[model samples]
Target chain A: MTGRDRKLTRFLRIAAFSIGMIFVLLGVLRGEHLEVFAKAVRICLECIGIG
Target chain B: MSGMHRDRVETKDRPGLHERFRLLIQLASAALVNGYAAGFAGCKIFTGTSKMVCLPVLNCYSCPGALGACPIGSLQAVEGGAKHNISFYVLGTLMLFGVLFGRLICGFLCPFGLVQDLLGRIPARKLHVPEKIDKPLRYLKYVILAVLVILLPMLAVNQFGIAPPYFCKYICPAGTLEGGIPHLLMNESLRKTAGALWNWKLGILILVILGSVFVPRFFCRYLCPLGAFYSLFNRFSLFRMDLDKSKCVDCKSCENVCPMAVKVTEHINSPECIRCGKCKAVCPVDAISSRFETDMLTRNVAVKKVD
Candidate 1:
């Protein structure tokens, strides 16, 4: 691959990583982590095929 | 045996140090995620602060010993909630894992993937899926991700404004093996409620077990939504495989030993590649190499500009 192509790929990877971090921050701000915790702590009946 | 088949058998007979190290990593990851042994005795799941986080792998949150939530399940839960919200946390966590390692999680950290790999070692005759069929079947996981994990949970709600985690409820054999069976075995009340859905999941679990024995990574290749999601970032993930064309002898040993059946020589960074390093391990000439993209970037920065 050319240097230009490598640079573009690197840029994209950095962008993706940045976007992911931003989303994680937003999710935390939205209290989605607590929602996840609430759902996970319970016995998910559907997960065990009871629901 | 055919040449490729013979090479595969030889590789199996003499696993390299890399293989042993990978096995150790897989075991450690499995143990770390499912470390609550006391939960199993009490027939209950972990309900600690750890559940606030999502695991990068396909481990079931409902598994008695699981300390963290499964990303896919968490996604579905948020999507299927009464408010119909999307789970940014799960999505971001998955994206981070995909960008960093891609499906290397599948090859090394996923408990279900480890199970399949172990079953594939049963010494029974393995089945080779024809390229025509295998190629089409590979797309099935993407469809499952789209429909069961995403669409159904978002769209199909009940009278109470809640939709089910379609994949975990109806399909995921991992859920059956990790959560369903163990819960039923320990909790008589749960067993009393077991019905057709439980039976269906058990059947799927059986099929997955049999399929894994006959064909390595059967679920990963055609069913795992998590693997499908991670595969999207494989081409540009920080972790990468580089094949030095000058040193390669076209021996096809790497291809033969690849559990994912990736066309390594033609496309070293194919999305299907799990970054397992089997290809690198089996390359007779040391032509194949693995590195993080950051390493290459650092080297390029140090070198004089030639371009």
Candidate 2:
């Protein structure tokens, strides 16, 4: 609630938001969307340990 | 043990409007992600475009009803892939969730958390986990996150240079319940081929379900890697608990009511806190509040105005 604390919180918020946005951009670039789709569509029996 | 703590329960026997609304949101969120008609038949996993992104909760990706992928499962899959690539998308999404709401997801949105909450209402004599054992056991989830979810998948590769999602394969009661059981129930062919690993997972699922009846959120408190991951960001999450020391009565009522056994007065924004608002609800002096105060920019500094 002090002036210093308020400023610190503000700075931290900006920093956190910046980092989150960067990572999201990286995710779009790094994540293989087609592979994600492939994994999502089929039932991996190994996931449930049958096969 | 304090008089205020004892008095707190009687005064608020029935849930207030906010609590009712929270439960409603939790139910709706669960159904929204996993409401596919084909899910009931367990014949197919949804291959929709929505499945490309991860949901904040621990809903299994393999669940027939799941429209969104489980972040933990996706992270493991990404780690175990032939590329052995670290999933910035999954990590980033989870990080965003953590910084925004923290474990409020556990309290208000997770389908698995809803299961535990309903089971906790079974009227059984609650088994209070002693703080000595509980404190150390809390670290187990972090270890699981590091080892089973991350490290094992990254390290333990086969002849094809790919690894399996060890956590989902060996642990994850969510996958077992939402994916395994449903598939087995619907697909008669799978039941005939059910092996020891399947039985092992079933045992773990049964134990977690029974344990929830006696200890509220047993999996969350001790086993959920997702909760552990979210807990790390609780201190600085956008939506957070704030204790106005000026209004506090030293009554310890908040501590008494907290399901997570968080020492609220000691650490108002403790990482273990699920932001259930139970402490705020029970506070006789209106000292405790949950606020959405990120910065001066979007500061909604509404205090404990809940009735």
Candidate 3:
């Protein structure tokens, strides 16, 4: 029973920590890859047939 | 049968003061957003848009006379301005909002969310998006943020010698529809020169609006870069929902009320949650409540002792 409680608690901790960090990482990534992303957009737009 | 019905009636309690307060919060938030939109649209800030503090909510920066800047829009603008060798005042402003309120902006005060709520209220039946499709579609907003929001500006500078907000251009039904088309219709001068672009934007707005009638906050789920930014703050944000299992009556009222389909008992702080407070209001045994930073620590201690 105690082991179950500890495991559940550990799961919550990991879930909470990982979820929060995902956003922080995504936010950072957004600002980081501006140049590569911009070029990709142009090529993709042309492929699909619009500017 | 009648005796049993009256017995059930007596057992079912009426709503209390807390319920009233919750309803009041919803009414006030919706009114504030709608009133501001009407006022901004009218340029009658004294009456219409005057109540919108613009600090707690997201509003487009290029909006005709918008008093405040959208955090995401500002971020992109600042990034673009920097690439063009200009000061990133816009991005700086966005960072300040992100740090200050976090995702509380989404919970308490986005006019677009209010629009979704109103559309959801329409008499038409609510449509359920299948989990298979909904799950995958949720990621589209991020891709939009990555490519349309981030990538386009970077490329335009590197290759084309021009940079513009691509998300706003291609995908943002908000700016194109919310701020652009409506304002132009009101201004006769702007209408005369209206071209294919205006028509295209109007068509996009109409399609999104129709989709919204069937889908709950489809734009927030799919398109809004601002929502994308605020979601980053969901965890560290001081505001939170607390569950007290001590009451031990897992009635599941909170889970049933959540519009976002969040497993409220499990994912109390999910970014998908807009914090509408409906769950807290509906709990029959008062199992859920709102918590702020330090107070939540005390509650957690209390929760530890519950069993």
* Number of the top-ranking candidate, with lDDT as the measure: 1
**TM per model?**
0.92, 0.90, 0.67
> Stretches of candidate 2 above 4 Å error?
A1-12, B1-16, B296-307
Q: Considering TM-score, which of the candidate structures 2 and 3 is the better prediction for this target?
A: 2
Interface RMSD (Å), each candidate? Answer: 3.0, 3.2, 11.8
Chain B TM-scores, listed for every candidate in order, come to 0.92, 0.91, 0.75
Would you list the C-alpha lDDT of every candidate in the order shown? 0.88, 0.82, 0.54
Query: Model 1 off-target regions past 4 Å?
Result: B1-14, B295-307
lDDT of 3 by residue, B1-307 (tens): 6997875554354334443554456557545444445445563323222311223455443444444434445445434544442213333334444444455566556766666666766778667888898888877777777776666666656444556656655565656544565556566665576666666666777777887787767777766777776666554445656677777377777766576666777777677766677777667666677665443222223334221
Interface RMSD of 3: 11.8
Ranking by lDDT: 1, 2, 3
Clashing pairs counted in every model: 0, 0, 5
Candidate 2 per-residue C-alpha lDDT over B168-235 given as tens digits, one digit per residue, 9 for 90 to 100: 88888998988888899889999999999998888999999999999888999989999999998887
What lDDT does candidate 1 reach at residue A35? 82
